[model samples]
Target: MAPQTSETEQVVDLNSWLPITASRKAKWWYSAFHNVTAMVGAGVLGLPFALSQLGWIPGIVAILGSWLITFYTLWQLVELHEAVPGKRFDRYPELGEHAFGPKLGYWIVMPQQTCVQVASTIVYSVTGGKSLKNYSMVAFIASTIRGSHHHPATYGVRSHTTAGQIFDVLNGIGTIAFAYAGHSVVLEIQATIPSTQKNTSKKPMWKGCVVAYIIVALCYLAVSISGFWAFGNVFAMPVFDMLESCLVQKLHFTPGRALRFAGRSTYVAITGFIALCIPFFGGLLGFFGGLVFASTSYFTPCIIWLVLKKPNRWSFHWIASWISIIIGVLIAVLAPIGGIRQIIISAKTYKFFS
Candidate 1:
């Protein structure tokens, strides 16, 4: 008979059980791919349209500024991942808990994190479905529907009303916020890389992130310059995939292939149905971006950093953090107003599943 280890002695290996956390042997290039996917997915396509709304200067500044600020914030997050010599904060919530009180931090971070992931999924569902629909329809059918002599695409803001132009600008901010929001997944992605005292995960993670940011800068510049174009929840697909595996495997709550399959399929169906109902990913990007993305990407980390690191008051880092916070707060406030207005306008002319 085999001897059993006591509960206290039973140290389960999470990497072996969970689908998301199981494989921690990923190399630097793997991080590059993940970062690229997280940063440059459907979000980039929306930039041109966002550019149209903001016009050349604000749009350009938004893209360039976001690139810099997010990168800086990303670095802060990477540093915080293993801030405690022997410990790792594997998730955003964990980091939040460490910075804020356990209860306060969880409440503050989890809702924003969940909203970003879930809202991203819902937005992506709409985008993917629309893409498939556009591709599947015959060229003749598409031309017939779109009209043989539709107005040529223009870069000017499409808003005619004073109120609409204001809304458009607000939505534009949200779109930019949404486009630059990869910070939420940084720690999670870093967690996949094996770390040692001599060689920490941050080095490779930062390297991969640098590569991804370069690609993002190039792609975004091109996309924003070209004629206005393209959701986005599709970008959040990885987050969704990870969530299921984590729940079943790490949580030890009925872990099985069946559970994974059933959970994922149900998730797909629900998101799809909602997409069909809304089918306005473009407009909603602003809402999602402002609603949660700003919190996750912009101010949340700054807040967390200030709380945990206590950077010197009136210093460069301190001033920059405040600037980020102010910007984030404005986005959170105005982006939703713009997005909701956009939704109302779209709904007036929209058909479900169309």
Candidate 2:
């Protein structure tokens, strides 16, 4: 006889269609590594510029706040996965389908996923292009400092006006959100942890979160603080301007105007090819993080939790979840304005080869 089905149950046939599966042999630490790897990618490179926009103190606060918010929401996702009996979702979209209906899941996750991938690709392309050119790190660092000398207006604090500071802080929020937007990896890694009966005190998943964030925090602080210290307010989005300027300074073999023009043309062509569709790496990161990741990392989880638990309207958790959702929405709305403004400002002085 065929197995019976409960009327309340929602069927998800993902196992047959999806290639990913839980690995029984994997431990929690391994899962944590996956989480760390997922969250800590090319996004770190943009942190310096992000810091510049937000200011040192405000930037650190924002980073910590975002981390805590993201971490709490991630824990909600974990708890949601274990809420029902005999039901497990291997993918984020799968969890969405189970929480809502299949159709809502499809619409919500599809665009968000596309944006994340697109943003990540842009970040990688910019980083890779710079790396391939083999720019001297020391020269780049020095030039970054010196670049501030020529553009003093661009390098230091522009205004103490409330609106100006708000805009500046908003400009960096997208990059902050982007750097910490790897919730999908957490779900994947959690799936791999083998349930243990001998000791249940420390959940491997939680331990992994702890470890991963420590590493992520260190990396983010190091890169961001260093970048801001080196270039201050004049820090470029992709940050390759420093490297390019350094390279140009060292090039004593410029063989006349024709050769230089040819070289510049070739450099532009190469960058154009590598940059793919997006020319402004930092702006794209901010836009994508705000438009897509805010929902996936913060808003969606809170919504899902609210739906699943159906807490009292005035309860603490309910209020907290709503607050998070509101913050996410605000970030989604406000971040793009700052990103677009930054892009427009950048365009006024943008050079193809530099």
- Candidate number achieving the greatest lDDT relative to the actual structure: 1
TM-score of 2: 0.72
Q: In candidate 2, what residue range of length 10 has the lowest lDDT sum?
A: 234-243
How many clashes would you count in candidate 2? 0
lDDT of each: 0.76, 0.66
lDDT of 1: 0.76
lDDT (0-100) at residue 51 of candidate 1?
82
TM-score of each: 0.86, 0.72
lDDT of 1 by residue, 1-354 (tens): 999866534324433555546667878888888887777755665776788788778888988988887887888898899998878887788899999889998789878887887777777778777774332123224434444345344446767778778989999889888888788788888888999888888899889989988887877776665434320003454455456646754776665687767777888788778888997776788888898998889889888889988999999889988988898889988898888887887898889888
Candidate 2 regions with alpha-carbon error over 4 angstroms? 1-19, 131-166, 195-202, 234-274, 349-354
Q: Taking the tens digit of each residue's C-alpha lDDT, what string does model 2 give over 202-282? A: 377778777888887777776676567666660111112212322344563332455445554565555456575445667
